[model samples]
Target: MAKNTYKQDEILEEPFDIRHLLRASSYIKKYQKRMIIAILLSSLGGAFGYIAPMITQHALDVAIPDKNFRLLFSLVIALLALYTGSIIFVTIRSKIMVEVSQNIIYDIRKDLFEHLQKLPFQYYDDRPHGKILIRVVNYVNSVSDMLSNGLINIVLESFNLLFIVIFMFLVDVQLALVVLCGVPILTVFMIWIKNKQRKAWQAVSNKNSNLNAYLQENIVGARITQIFAREDENAQIFQDLSQDCRRTWNTAVRYSNLVWPGIDAISVCVRAAIFLFGLVIFGEGNKSLGTIVAISSYASFFWQPIMNLGNIFNNFINNIAYLERIFETMDEPVTVSDKENAKEMPTIRGEVTFDHVAFSYDETKKILKDVSFTVKPGESVALVGPTGAGKSTIVNLISRFYNVDSGRVLIDGQDISEVTIHSLRSQMGIMMQDSFIFSGTIGDNIRYGKLTASEDEIRKASRIVCADDFISRMPEGYDTEVRERGSMLSQGQKQLISFARTLLSDPSILILDEATSSIDVQTEKALQTGLNAMLQGRTSFIIAHRLSTIRGCDRIMYIDDGGIMETGSHEELMAKKGYYYKLYTAQLEEVHKTA
Candidate 1:
């Protein structure tokens, strides 16, 4: 396969903003009482802490000197009480934060997974599976942690800062002015660094998504890559992508790292200024030694926590950045939705028709143009074409994976859009080229088509498709586990399993796209022969390269360049000597030569 290219990449990064955080507050607010209590306790601790040093300073400078041993003892007790209370508050706060984070994560995970289930197949087609998985992991996890810490830090720290300032001003008005003036400047720098760090983190996230997508695709398609000897090329591409991802992550960490140090340096400078000025004021007797000691202690204390706050704010902003990504996905309105009063179609007859249909993946490029076809009830039709001739697109439309741009698709004389998805899809059985064998027993895999299918029904369906021959040969038979996509089975056996799975549905409409492409000639013949029993009285669309298998089909449609160029029985098409005749003759002569 060739590497795919797109004209432009999406700008995945958004400005770090709290509007999304506010929107998701309800999810976190469920633990509001606990969070508030945690913050309240932390505030009480911080308040006691700020007052302890002041009390100690007064006792040291005056109480002890005046032979007031009782006052000194009281101040020491106050310091002990402050530390003891803070320890208790810290323990409770940590526990509550953990619960809040986990709870929020649970809600986010559920919301995202459910939303994915409700999204249309077209959404998955346009986006890579790995990219989706990355969002679920990186963005969602980020939001979960951020919501908890961001809420608590803002509340506790704000209270702590307020208490420190209030008492500092009471001790000496001028010293408070100096610290307040510099505080804004430090805040400005912290916010600036946080914004930049947020952008870098988002960049790493986007690149990591692409890296994950590449790794997933390469792993799942490793066999094909090895067969084509493209392993070396893929390895090199992955190596380059991995390095790019590393560089992006390192850069994000570097900028975020700068935030804390920058705040610390500003704090250190402010503390030094307060102390030098305080010494001069004390010598002038404008302030007492106890007042100077208290003022210096408060200013020094201010720097470390508020400076460490540069980190909390950075995380706060980083969390908000993740918030934007989550909100972006969650905020997308379901463009394709069932009607408000749509009724489930009961037991459709599979009368599928496209009335002069035209369609496109996007506005500018038309992939299917003015095409019309009908699959009558209980009829089998084979569609043949070169790649990009719109065969799969036609089948997708029948499945209503994408609605037509300017035409109507009627199912059993009813517009499909009027019917519910469950009823419409339940009637159709699709065996796609890349089969999905979920992790479960053989019986479970077969029963995926109809959840309510019993073991006997599943076995009977497999027996109809001749899969019982090998299935019974297995150690545990139908109960055997098929881990990691039935790797234990060969290509032909997997195809047989797919056939059996589709048949268990007993659908009114059936579609097989390159269904036998992976099987051998003998097995393909047997599979098709087995299919004959299941095909009767069902509308079917079969797209195959082996022209011989569809000889019994009522009509063979030769699709070319988004339109049907010819349609007739195998013998009728062979007589025409057109595109269908050439396609048929090429395969026929090759088989004869092989014989």
Candidate 2:
């Protein structure tokens, strides 16, 4: 198997941007009151946690030493009550965070999907579907834990760390200073680890995108693989992709896993040194047993938040990579947007004209050169050309799928670029060579053209396109389930359904781009008869493979090398003995050879 591999040299090494989190937070800003309450509750929990240790110090220093049983029992009850209150506060805060995070995720995903819808066709053409899907679905979810737990943890733990430091100094200044030393050391270590972890996560994300793209391609081309008997080869390639993803994911995990243990190790060393130094320097005469115990407890409490912070920081860094990918997609410029003063197209008269238009998908190659043409209302024009000769480009421009690089496309003598795209496209119908039939019943697919269409209208449209005969013969008769992309239907059947869909819209302008190329001879005659009837009194552009199909068209155009080489009726073009003549004769000879 020959595998095409690209270098994964772009590694993420930038420091996590606070602005990313700030932007994400903006979505949930409406719930600020609830978030504030949650943070307060978390702060309350941290404050309550100090009670148990304080009660212990008191019991050991005074109550037990003085043999006061009643005081000891009272302190025990206070200890239990304080710890229970802390648990309740944490539980309530977790609930609030969960709700806020879920709503924020929903808003973000909705915005992403809506933005993708508004993006130009060229945007989708340049990127794989799998990468876009990953950003919308997987990347949005990756930020959930960070938004939910990471946020509340950062606030509450900072307060907890502050309170612990204050109490440590109050207990013993020397021990407090020893505890503070671990802060800088751990902070430096985390900063170093963060850089490595970010790169690892970026690699993992890239690998996942590659794997998704590969899987999607293989699934769509499964039939081709089977036909070529290359299943084993393809499977090997998939295995390689999966292994690469797993390897990168493990690297990220390895770096993240180092965070907690490193924090805990420093914590242990700090505590050990505090105890040893306190005893060695300030003997038993200076520091009381209760004071030593209290200081040790305070030291652990101080380091505990730092340890928890280490875990939260790991999730924060991991999701930052996901946020970068997500925001990058969101920031994609919508190049083809309507002007601020764009007008809504009124009832269309369907007189389309292109004046000296030129277009190039890229700088190196031009798809359409300086071309000019006009189709009067109700005119049926057939565009006949060899492959890659700009026949489809002309139709695409009329529909405003791609704006012309130079010159103007006008409908009813009004520039299309000055009209709202939705209003302009509403009155037009386009059917491509590959008919896209989504998953649904036959009737439902037809009704998609006009959602307000009644059942009778659907059946009538099907009958007009000659699809009703085959549809009625099915087991369910217009109710038959068409699998995804209409896989269950023959090529002819899909084309008929597509025709039915287009015709049901009652469009003023219709485009058929090689629609009957894949259809059989018998189906083509039936389709042509129906189409010729429907095309009456409507502006139509037909791209035909069989030259014989365009004889009835009002005019025939022979396009070559991005220019119109010849234009006339079939009889006139044949009489001229030009490019159209040669093309028609070549096609006719080929048909005779097949016969």
Candidate 3:
């Protein structure tokens, strides 16, 4: 193992600033008596370390002065006892340190995960998954190491330094004072190096996170990149990020190299001066050979604590910055939150209405302009429009995915804002244009719809949505593992599973945002059969591109410039010969020619 040296310049911010550390340690300290035992043991170990050289000096000096073999044997036994006791104390302290650090890491990970669960959908929209992942990984584990071995070492080193100083002064105050003078210079060197490396390490960590983010986004959007023929451009961009990270890491290494050489020079010069001075005292017939050896040993002791302090401070500072980020995330005020007296809803009848709603994501660009609509209980509505026509915004509004900017969205005539989000969300299901599937056993994926759902329920829901046909054809049926994003399954099969998931929930309102846009005609026809049954008595919003999907909807509305331009039954919209007529006519004729 590498020896740790104190870098005076590396003294980081106070360890107490991190509230989580204080809070975490508070629990450990609750077992204050136990920690005191560890502290006592560590102090015992440090004390014994200083006494070893003194005992040796005594054995050499007195064994001859008294011409007594019996006295020499007793001194040898005393030294052995000190070694044995030190070992026992250190072992106990190590165990306690490990236990405390593990518990702290446990609390950090759990609290972070819980906080993430409570965040709204838009919170995830702006953040990258990889950046979030680094917190649970790179940051937490590093902090754990610092808490365990690093903290214990620091405490022990301090005790050792104090013991060495006192022992040195007792034997030779003049030499000890000379050695102490160099400490301030070492401290200055440390501060300069620490600041330089601190900035560099932070840069590397940030760039590493960015690189991971780029990889994650590109991998997930690979299909789009390949279709657009932009793979080479993205690859080059990722390369640039990787190189930037490398540059930062190299810069930190370059500055850190200066510390050891600078410290080494100080150590050599001081040791040389002490050696020459001690030899002169011996020559003057006042000091014994044993005294010089003990003083040299004391000198070795001083550097370890000083050097160790420097190293601990450097890493501690860098690691604290990471903890600061975690605390910041924990402290962020949630824009939407569950009410103090929130009630859980068990059953729902869907009647969705928007009363004079106006909304915008950014303050300057209004997306929904005075939009008003109503769907009676069990009525299905289709929102049709050109791109960026705010078709998807209507579905988002009903689900309360984003709170209305200036209007009220009512579910079953109860304002959604007044109802608990958990209560409102339970009654709604949304299937977006792009489906998501996690890597897990097929059974686990289905159970995600309702976390507490039983195996029988999962199987029945899969069967109702016609997913059973393909699922059974697989080698393991419902037990098959779905690799990342369900890549192992066909696109149609993934869509079927997604449909099965929502079916298991049995939501009162279903929002289908171009749900069938990815599947083929044959699979679409199969899915539509089950979907029709699912939406029969439930209020639903369908954002459709294919005319067939919206044909049976209760009302079909053509939206343009953030308002409903026309709305009626599908047939009624076709009869109007307006925007909807042109869209349906163009799509219908294209399908007819292909047939």
Clashes (N, CA, C under 3 Å) per candidate: 0, 0, 9
Worst 10 residues of 1 by lDDT: 1-10
- Model 2 lDDT per residue over 13-71, tens place: 44689898888887757777888899999888888887566678888989999999999
Better of 1 and 2 by lDDT: 2
Looking at model 3, residue 431 earns an lDDT score of: 87
Shift in Å, residue 147, candidate 3: 4.8
Superposition TM-score, candidate 2 onto the true structure: 0.92
Q: How do the residues 1-595 of candidate 3 rate in per-residue lDDT, one tens digit apiece?
A: 0111111111223353666666546434544566567778999987987898887778777775777889888888988999988898899888987777777688777877888777666677766766767777777777777766666677777888888999988877777876787788888887888788777777777777777767777888898999999988987887888888799889978887877787788777777767777678435546676776777778777877887887888777777766666766667556676667766654678878889899777677888889888889899998888988888988887777777788898777777777788787877888888778899988788878799989888888888778888888888988898899998887777877888888788899998898888788887787777888889888889997887888999899898887889999977887889999998899989999999
Better of 1 and 3 by lDDT: 1
RMSD of 3: 5.3
> Taking the tens digit of each residue's C-alpha lDDT, what string does model 1 give over 144-210?
8778877688777777777888888887888777777678888788778777876787677667777
Model 2, position 574, has a per-residue lDDT of 96
Candidate 2 minimal-lDDT segment of 10 residues? 1-10
Candidate of highest lDDT: 2
How does each model score on lDDT? 0.80, 0.84, 0.78
lDDT of 1: 0.80
lDDT of 2 at 170: 73
**TM-score for each model:** 0.89, 0.92, 0.90
